[model samples]
Target: MSVLDRIIRTTTADLGARMVRIPAAELEARALMAPRRPSFAAALCAPGLSVIAEHKRRSPSRGAIRVDLELTEIVRDYERGGAAAVSVLTEERHFGGALDDLTEAAWVCGLPLLRKDFVVDRYQLLEARAAGASAVLLIVAALPIRRLEELHGAALDLGLDVLVEVHDAVELDVARSIGARIVGVNNRDLRDFSIDVERTYRLLDGMPAGALVVAESGIRGVDDARRLAAAGVDAVLVGEALMAAPDPRLACEELACACG
Candidate 1:
């Protein structure tokens, strides 16, 4: 099986276990009680290229980028460095992250939090809201069009923004079909986990005009971020490079400044 297949299987298994522990009704109740989060979608559209710095512990491709840092500290560092938003990798098995990581980020920082996970079920959306996430990532390669539509609607209903991620023209059509306003173009190919920064350049012109374009993955530094900004990307989701930097706050400042 490909890496994407493995992620799907792992997510499926984890979903079952999570539901058994929290149950859907309880999760929804928690969401209903939590304070409303501001529009994470609007933050990306602010003038100049916005930065969505990521808090990722490990990945299938790269192991343990920053195992020593605390979520509260790292996310606060991102905020101090002028990140417009923060993406918390919550994929557990593959990414070595948890829902509590997002929760802690939200608790400690004022930046809008995006739950970066393979969302196959609505349960995850409720879980995210309960955990204080203001937005969630919906990968086109992970779910069928019908499922995507349902989850997209469900997330909006809960007052959470959905970053409808597309990898190609066909996926962009699916996003448009659901009226997705925030668009993320991932440079990494999910099937084989290969990355090419030019992938965003290739498909971006085809995206809907005025849709928030977020370039994800393979952001190495200020120069790479500047290239994306020049390409008209509204924001960039940088992970490994920032996480591994000797001074993450400085790294974020340099990247954001480069975008400007």
Candidate 2:
């Protein structure tokens, strides 16, 4: 099986187990009781190219990235460096992250939280809200068009902004069909896990007008973000680059300052 296939299989199975423990009804109740989420989509559309600094302990391609980072410390650093929003990876097996990582960050800072996870069901949306996430990622390649639309609608119903992620033109169409307002162009191909910054450029023209676009992955530094910003990107979701930097705060500051 391809890497994407494996990841989805694991996600679906894990979601099933989680459903048994907490139940969707309980998740919904918890979400209803939680405070209203901040607007993640608006954050991207702000003045200059906004920076959505991401927190992740590891990845399938590059394992164990800055696992020692305390959620509160690094997240506070991102905010201090002028990040517009924060993305916390909550995928368990491959990313070495958990929902607790998001809750902790939310507790310390007020930045809108993106629950960066391989979300396969509506249950995950409720879980995201309960964990204090202001936004959730909806990958076009992961679900069928019908399911994608369902989840997209579900996110809005829960008052969470959806970052509908697309890798190519066809997926872009799928996102558009759902009337996605916030679109993310991911540079990494989920099938083979290859990286190419041009994916964002190649898909830009296909995006709906007035949509807030975020360039994701393969953004190494300020120059990379500048190149993308010149191409009309509204925001950049950077993870691995910041995780590996000698000084994450300085690296984020440079990107945020330059992009703006």
Candidate 3:
């Protein structure tokens, strides 16, 4: 099986166990269950291209990136530095992140938070809501059409925005078929973990109009974000580059300026 397949399979099993550990009702009772204040989509449409700064410690490919930065300090800086939103990695196995990271970021930073994870079940959506996330990411490569539609609907019911990630044309088509508007073109190929920054531009040719496009992964510097913003993406979700920086706030500011 491909890496994507294996990751999804493992995610499915892990999610099943996670749900049992924290029942849906229990998650709903968390203080964060109330709808988030800011809107990620609204941030995307702000004056310049948006920046979804991240709080991540590691990844499947890069291993450890920022294991020491506390969520309170990192997220506060992102918000202070004018980040459009914050994308907190919630997958523990591959990304040295946890649900507590999401909750902590939300508690610290008032900006909208995207629960970045391989979401495959409705339970996770509810978990996101309870964690004070204003948005959730749904990878088109991981779900079939029916399940995608189901999860999207559930997210809407919870007052959460959905950013559907697509790596290529086929998945993009599936995302559109499911009526996803906020689309993230991931530059990293999950199968082999290879990155081609040009993937966003290449895929932009076939993207449907009216879909808010976001470039995800492999964005390492100001120039990378500048190129993507020049290509007309609504925003960029940059994790590793900023997290690994000595000053994540400065990195975020540079990226935000690059959008111009």
Candidate 4:
């Protein structure tokens, strides 16, 4: 199986165990009572290329990425650096991340939060809402068109913004078909975890008009951010570069300036 397949399988199994422990009904109740969240999509639409600084502990391709820093500290650094929003990788196992990370970021940062995870079920949407996330990610390569439509509709019904992620022309079409308001063009190919920054550029023309465009993955520094911003990208979601920096705040500040 490919890396995406394995992660999805593991996520399914783990989600099942968690569901048993905390019933879906309980999650729903918490979601309802959860405080209002800031507008994640709006944050990206502001004038320049917004920086969505991400908190990622590690990845399947690049493991052990700055695990020493506390989640709250990392988020605060992102905020102080002028990040438009924050993305918290909530997948465990392969990513070495936890849902608590999103909760912690939410508690510590005033910026909007995106629950970056393999969302295969609506239950995860409830989890995102209850955890104080302003938005959630939905990768087009991970789910069927019908499933994507269902989850997209479900997320909207719950008043949560969805960043529909696409890696290629086909996936971009799928995202457009689903009326994705905030579309993220991921440079990394999920099947093999290979990254090509040009992927975002290649797919830029096919993007839906007026849709908020976000470039995800493979963003190395200011140059990359500048190029993407010039190409009309609304935002860039960067993780490894910021997480690995000696001073994540300074790193984010540099990127944020370049992005704008």
Q: Give the C-alpha lDDT of model 3.
A: 0.85
Q: TM per model?
A: 0.98, 0.98, 0.94, 0.99
The C-alpha lDDT values of all candidates are 0.90, 0.91, 0.85, 0.94
Model 3: per-residue lDDT, tens digit, 1-260? 87788878878898889878987777767634465658878888887688899888887788888877788999988988778999998887777778888878877788989999999988888888888888999988888889999999889878889999999899988888888879999999989889988889988877777888999998888887777777788898988888999998898888877774
Clashes of each: 0, 0, 0, 0
lDDT of 2 at 95: 88
lDDT of 4 by residue, 88-188 (tens): 99999988889999888888888999999999999999999999999999999899999999999999988899999999999999999999999999999
- Error in Å for residue 138 of model 4: 0.3
Clashing pairs in 4: none
TM-score of model number 4: 0.99
**C-alpha RMSD values across all candidates:** 1.0, 0.9, 1.7, 0.7
Clashing pairs in 3: none
Cα error, candidate 1, residue 84 (Å): 0.2
Model 4 superposed RMSD (Cα)? 0.7
Model 2 alpha-carbon drift over 4 Å, by segment = none
Best by TM-score: 4
The alpha-carbon root-mean-square deviation between model 2 and the true structure, to one decimal in Å, is 0.9
User: Runs in model 4 with CA error above 4 Å?
Assistant: none
